[model samples]
Target: METVVGIEDTEDGKFEDSGVDRSSSALSSPKQISNPIVYKLVRVEGDGRLVPATDDEVMEVGDFLECENSEMHVVADTGQSLECISIERSSSGNLQLECSEGTAEADMGKLNAKLQYIEQILQKVKEEEKQRISCGSPVHSHLNVDSQCSADKFPAMDGKVQSENQEIPSIASSLNYTHSSGSIDQCSRPSEGVIESGSSASAVYSNLKPDLSMSDGEICLDKLSIRELHELFKVTFGRETTVKDKQWLKRRIAMSLTNSCDVSATTFIIKDNKIVRKFEEDSSGNLNAASLISLENMTEEEDGNFKDSSPVKDCGSDDNRVVSETRLGNCSIGYELEDENHQTEQRAAKRIRKPTKRYIEELSENESREHNPRLLISNKSTGHGHVSPTSYVRPAARNVFSEVRIYVTRSDYLGGSDVQIPCVSRVRRSRPRKDNTSLMKFHPTGMSETATKLSNKLLEHCSDAGSEIPDNVLKSRMPAKFHQPASSEPAKEKQCPTTGTAELRQELRPKRADSCSHTSDDDIVTVPTAKGGMRRKHHRAWTLIEVMKLVEGVSRCGAGRWSEIKRLSFSSYSYRTSVDLKDKWRNLLKASSALTPSPADDGMNSRKHGTAPIPEKILLRVRELAEMNSQVPPSYSSSNLAAGAGSVHGRDRSGYL
Candidate 1:
C-alpha cells in the first residue's frame, strides 16, 4: 500500500509555509476552513518505491524537529487510522512529515489520546499568544503576570511531547507538562476537566484556534532566513556570532527588539570593593537569592532543576505558585548572563600565559648585553658588533703597575737657618724598549768579536769609577751601542768570550749573518698595518748609487734570483731584503720600458717627479740584460720582457749615460 506523509511547520502558534498546499494535500479542518492546519507532504510511497520530497512539494523543518523514521498513526476526519510513513532529507533541508495511511478500523481510545496531546500543544500556544498580546506593554509584564507560568514552558515541552507521542502509545500517561504549583492549576486542570467526547476532526481542532495576537515584528522574524537572522544578530549585538541555531537567533533578536534581558540582566554595583547584584521582585513578595546564586552556570533547557530547590511554603497555593515562578524567572536571567560572561572570559584568557623564569632571564640578559657600555666597547673593539653572551670569552685580569713614587725632603739653609726644600725626586722603574731583531735566535760565537770590545769598554769604565756612582750619571755616560751594526758599517773584530772569569758580564752581540740591520739613513719606522701587525715604513728616497747596484746584481743573477742577488751583490745594503730587490727591479723594468729618448746632453733621461733618478744609459743597460736572460720581473712575464727587449735594442742608444 502507498503511504503519504505530511508535516506541519509551526512556531509560537503561527504556521509558516511548508511547500505542500493547504487545499490539495493538507488536512482540511472542518472549522476555520480558510485558515487550515496546513501540512507539507514530506514523502510518498507507491509500488514499494520511495520518492523523496522536493522543495516545491514539501516545506523543510529539519532544524525545527528531530525524529527517527517509524510508524505514527494519526486519526483522520473519517475516523480512519493513517500511518506516518517516515522522515527524510532533501537538497533543501530536513523534511519531516506526521501523517497516517488509511485504516478502516481505528482504536477509539488511542485516537482520543493523540487528539488530546495535539489539542494541549495548540491550546498552550494560543494561551501564550493571548498573554503576550495582553501584556503588550512589557513594563507590567514582569510584575503583573497573573498566570505565574514561564513564557518558555510550552516550547520546553514541545519536542519532548512530540517524540513521546510518536513512539510511546501511552504517551498521555507518561507526559506531564506541569510546573511545581502554577502549572498544576493552569495546565493540569484543563487536561483533567475537558474529556472532549467526539472523535470527529472538527471537534478536535474546533477549540485549537489559530493565534493572530503576534505582532508584525514577531511575524517578520518567523519569515526571516538563517542568514538574515545572522545579519540581524550582528546589528543588534556589536559583534558577529558563529552560532547557527535558528531558534536561538530568533529568540535573541526578539529579546533585543523588545529590549528585554536574556535572563533578567542583573545590574551590579561595587560596594566595599566587592561585586553585588541588585535585588529583583515580582508582584509577590519572594526573595530570589537562592536562584541567583545557584543559576550561575545553568541554561534555559535545565530550568526544571529550579523546582527541586524552590522554597517550600506553608502558605496558600496562590502564594506558592508566585514564589516558584519568580525563582524560575531569576534562574533564567542568571543563566543567560553567566553564559555570555563565561564565553567572554574564555576568549580573553586564551592568549595569556606566564613566562618561564629561564625565558625571562634570557630577555633580561640580552637587554643588558645590548645596553651595557663595557660590553659594547669590547664588542666594537673586537670587530664583532653584537654577539651571543655565550660566545664572548671574558678577558683575563690586567696587571695594574704602580705609578712613580715622589719623595719630599726638607733641609736647613746654611746662612738664614730657614728650612729649604730640596727638589722632589721621582723614583721610576724604567721599561726596556722592544727590539724587532730579538725575534730570531743567534749564536754567541757569531758576535764574539763585538762582545769582547763591549766588555773591555765596560770594564775600563767601571774601574775608572772608584767611588759609588749615581745610576743616572752612569747611564748617561754609557754609549748607545746597539746589538747589531748595519752592513754599510765596517765588520767588527772577532774575539772569544773569557769563560775563565767567575763574574758575569753583559756583552753586546754581533747580529747573525741572516739578520739585517736598519741604517739611520733609511726612513725605517714601525707602523701598524691593516691586520694589526707592524711593518717597516719605507718612505726614504733611493740614491742613484743604489739603482746602479740593483742593475749590476740583476745582470749577474738574472731577474728571478732576488735572494741570491741580495746576499752576493747587495749584502752591504742591509735595509734592503730579497723582497725589496724584486720590487726595485720590477720598478726599474717599468721605467726602462716607459722612458722615451729625451734631449739631455749628459746622455741621461730627464727625471720625472716620482721616478727614480736613473740615467738613460742605465735603463738601456737594464733592458739589454732583461732581454738577454729571458727572465720575468715580479708582475711581468718573460715573453713580454723578450718582446720588449727587441724593441729597446731597435731604439737609439745615444742617450746612454
Candidate 2:
C-alpha cells in the first residue's frame, strides 16, 4: 500500500495542522485524517444523495451531493458509516437510511438548535416546579414516616382529612398543613407552606395502580389543593370525577350512624366525625398517627358497608305494640268513659230470651191473617126460627107518633113522647042571623084584621111549641111585597040618590064574592091533600109567584096551618088536611127548595134562593153552633147526642141532603 494508517494512532487521533486551524474540521487539510467528529444526520435538501465525504471534503449532515451519478446527502456520521450504516435512495424515490449501533449526528447548526430547544424545555420545567411548590402538593420531602402535617397547615382542606390522624406531634410550628390524622401538630415551616408526609405520597402513588378492588371506587377531584391526590384519584377512578362522590361517602357514613345508634347519639357522632379523630388505642395504649389515618381511610372506604350492616330500629313505646284495627267508613264505638261500665253491665245482663213458640206462632198467624182476605159474614149455628143476634133490624116505633115525637125533640129533651094536653075552652059561633042586616053590621074589614091578628098569635104559639121551621121551608117563601098588587088609578064617580046607592051595593057585593072565591082556591092550592092524592088534583096548582109568597109567609111565621099563619092569607079559603100538616109542609118545602135546575135548563132558575145564597144570619148562626159544639167535649154522652142531633139533622140537613 502507499502508506499504511496506524490503527493505534487513529485510536487516539489528534489534529496538529499548523496552516489549517485545528479548532474546526472545515479548516483542516483534506488528506490528513485528523480528529473526526461524529454527528447524526437529521434532514436533507431536495434530490440530495449521500456519498462518503472524504477527509478532505467538508461535509454537513444536511449537505446534498452526487455519488456515482446518484443523488444523496451526508446522512450518517463516520462512526455510523464504520458500522456499515448508509442512506440511499430507494427505487420509489425515497431515502432509506439505517444504522446498526450508532446514530448519525446532525449538522452543527441543527445540533445547536436542538440543544437550545432542550434548554427552553428545562426552563419551562423549572417554572412548573416553582408553581407546584407555591400551590401545595399532597406530599413533601420533610415529613417523617409516622409524623403528619400540622392541623392548620392546610387551612382550605376539609376537616375530614384532618380528623383522619390525631397522633402527629408538632414540628414545623408555623406550618398550616393538616395531616390526614386529625391531631393539631404545629411545625416550624411557614404558615402558608404545606408539609405532606412521604408515606402519604407513597400511599397515593400505590393507590394509583389499577386494582380490581378499586375498580368500582368513585373519586372526587374537586377544589382540593392536593395535586398528587387529584392525580391518584384520576388514575384510580378513570378520570370522570365530580363532587357527588364525596357527597355519597358522607351520606353513607351519616346513614350508618343514624341506623346504628339512637338519634341523639348518632347525630353527635356524625357531627364529631367531621372535625375530631376517632381512634382505637394500641396494645401499649399509645395512639399511632399512622394508625389513626389508616382508621379514617378504612372508615371512608367502609362507609357503604357500614350503612348496609346496620338497620333502623323501632323506638316506639309499649302502647304501640298492639296493632290497631282500622274502622270502616269512620264507624266507631263513640261510648264515653262513664258509659264503659254501663256497656259492660248491659252486655253481661243480656240474655237470649227467645219468644215462646206459641207467641211466635201467634205472631206469624196474625201476619198471615192480615194478608188474607176477610170474610163478610161470621159462621155460627142457631136453632130453627132463631134470629141471629148479629143480624141488625131497626126496632119499630113503639107508639103511633113515636117517629114524629122524636123529630120534635128539643135541645133539652130526652127520649120521650110527651103529648101536649089541650086546655078546652068553649066559644059560641054566632048563628047566621035570619035578619042579615042587624048582625052583619060588624065591619068586614075589622073582622079581617082580627082574623089576621088571631093567625099571627096562633103562629107564635106553634113556634113556641117547639115546631121550628126548616131552613129550606123558610128559604122557599116568596118576598113579602111580591103578592101585594100595585095600586090602580081611581074610577070615575057619578052622583045619584037611593037608586044609585042600591045599584052600587049590588055591584060591589057581587064583585067581592067573585074576588073572595078566586083568592080562596089560589091559597088552598099550596096545601097537601089528606088522602095523599096529587096536590094539584085536590088543590089549585101554585104559580111560582104564589109559591114564593107562601114560602116568604112560612119563613116569617114558621111552618103551621092557616090558623097558625102570622099574617092574613091573601087567598082566604086554603086549608091543610094532613094530620101532621106542619111536618108534611116542612118536608114539601124542603124538597121544593132542594130542586135545582137541570143541566138542560128546564125553564127553572138554577140558583136556590136560600141554599145558594145562604143568608148572613144563618151562616152566623151556623158558625156559632160550631163554636159551641167545639167547646163540648166528645166524652159527654148528652153533649154527643146534642151535637149529633143538632149538626146532623138541623142546620146540617142541607149538606146531608
State which candidate has the highest lDDT. 1
* Global Cα lDDT for candidate 2: 0.19
CA shift of 134, model 1, Å = 99
List per-candidate RMSD values in Å: 46.8, 66.8
Candidate 2: tens digits of C-alpha lDDT, residues 1-657: 000011111111211111121112221012222442112221222112112333222232212221211221122112111111010000000001111001112333332222222122222222333443455443212211112111111211222111111111011000001010111101111111111221222232122211112111111112222443333233222243454455443323222211111100101111112212232111100111111222223324223322222111010100000000000000001111122332233224222212121111111111111111111011010000111121110000000000000000000000011111100000001111011111111112121111111111111111111011111122222122111111100100001111111211111111011111122223223346586643432222222222333333333333343233312322211122222234434534344344332324322331342112232323333333334444654356244535444553444335312
Candidate 1, residues 100-211: lDDT per residue as tens digits?
A: 1111122322222222233333333333433433343342222212111222222222233233323321121012111111121121111101111111112222322221
Stretches of candidate 2 exceeding 4 Å from the true structure: 1-537, 560-562, 574-590, 597-657
Local distance difference test values of all predictions, in order: 0.25, 0.19
- Model 2 lDDT-worst window of ten: 322-331
Q: After superposition, how far is residue 129 of candidate 2 from its true place, in Å?
A: 99
